[model samples]
Target: MATIRIGLDRLPPAARAAVEAHTGPLLTVEETAEGFNSEIAARVTSATGTWHIKGLRADHPRAWTQRREAAIAPFLTGLGPALRWREEVAGWDLLGFDVLNGRHADYAPGSADLPEVASLLCRLGETPCPSIELRHAEQRLEHYVVRPDLRFFAGPHLLHTDLNNANVLVGDHAAEGDRARLVDWAWATRGAAWLDAGYWVIWLIAAGHTPVSAERWAAEIPSWHTAPAEGITAFAAANANVWSEISTADPDPWTLRLADAASAWYAHRRTG
Candidate 1:
């Protein structure tokens, strides 16, 4: 019998068997362009119906990474349909969901589904971060702060961290259903809520829409730099030494501009 390669070899035996049994005569298997994490998409046929199997790579040190989909699946079931099913015999973290039969980026700013997409993001943000150890807030500030080449904005909020457009899937639905669904949750992290917004803003600008110009983008940086100090004085006071290095790794021009703007804003606030 021919074998279906769904990349589930590392899952527990029960989970592996479940995938193999469900995915019969795997007609095709290939990697998906969804996220940075290793993911494989497989199409298989069975007596009951055809199925798509999404198997995440198990080669990472973080066990939580592999279980992310299953962890959030239950919470998102009613909010958005959840189609993930797994087996214990299989050693991989495999999730089987209905294959989306449409383009992922079809929905844009004016699309009727834009508000729903934003709403979904707001809801996802509401789901508290899992118990995985997060980088210390001060440490994050230190790493991104000191490099004279970058600027830092400090705040404590949960962020998706990576919500670029490609991760959003746009599909046709029944006349009254949601037309867009957001997927891929591997980079979820606890940070500034505006960090997610800022990142998406950059993505949108890079994609060629002029939502915020260079000047407005430049102006927002200083406001962010001053934000943490305004509300969380104690935290900012404690972390002041490390904040200087926070923006070091972020070499992107827009990020640098924002950092510069923030630095100027900080200086102005101190004097006035």
Candidate 2:
């Protein structure tokens, strides 16, 4: 799902006009090369202020992601970028957010950023799931988890299952603790409190953490410590299957790497 790279000037006239109404003529545009689903993704400087603008064509396969992000963003508290405004013009949907000035998080073992990531996970654990109906863990993983145990994944906690390092930002601007922010909420779910940490372990491995070290990182979140081992086992097996299917379907370098990581973590859990 490659997003079409588009700048402020690339937007349709109506869409461009709608955005410029809030932000004046774009003085500078810095386009982003990452993200799997966005036709327009960039940081634009205008007379008003800099805003991170992202959007997709109305009929694109992943167009709903922008809407989902906007719908759940307010409930995120401080977890992700604030959605200042949104608009649809010329068959494209767009969103504007206050640009965050932070580096993408480093997930390497022993990096100081891990603690901030853990802290953000802890903060999210405390956020009661919003009333918005979200996919339950069991439902979302139904195809992957063999003999799925509904009890193992039951809960009402909001879960940000996709914690890719790129979606996280860490910086030294905070008054005391490490400053970290989570983004890309399209895959956010409602599940047991421990599920997000469980998912992070896979990403940690993908970023070069041995399974033991990755589990150590997961342990930093209180929910991880208290999570039932059976639930963890279920999630591990399910995720391994999910990643395997993704790798098989795409076979892209990243998908292959993550498949291996998920398999490695599953093997670790099986042995210990």
Q: What are the per-model C-alpha RMSD values against the true structure?
A: 8.5, 1.4
Clash pairs for candidate 2: none
Model 1 alpha-carbon miss at residue 153, Å? 7.9
Clashes of each: 31, 0
In lDDT terms, which candidate is top? 2
The segments of candidate 1 whose C-alpha lies over 4 angstroms from its true place after superposition are 1-16, 23-31, 43-45, 49-52, 56-64, 78-83, 87-91, 106-116, 125-142, 146-158, 174-177, 211-272
What tens-digit string does per-residue lDDT give for candidate 2 at 1-272?
A: 35657676777899999988889998998988768778788898988799998889899888878888888889876788899999988998999988878998999988888989999999999888888857788788888776556567778899988888989988787843448988788887888899999999999999999999999999989999778887787788888999999889889999998999999998888888
**TM-scores vs. true structure, each candidate:** 0.56, 0.96
**Ten contiguous residues with the weakest lDDT in model 1:** 234-243
Candidate 1 structure lDDT = 0.47
TM-score of 1: 0.56
In terms of lDDT, model 2 sits at 0.86
- Model 1, range 180-221, lDDT digits (tens) per residue? 555655555556544544444444444443433322332333
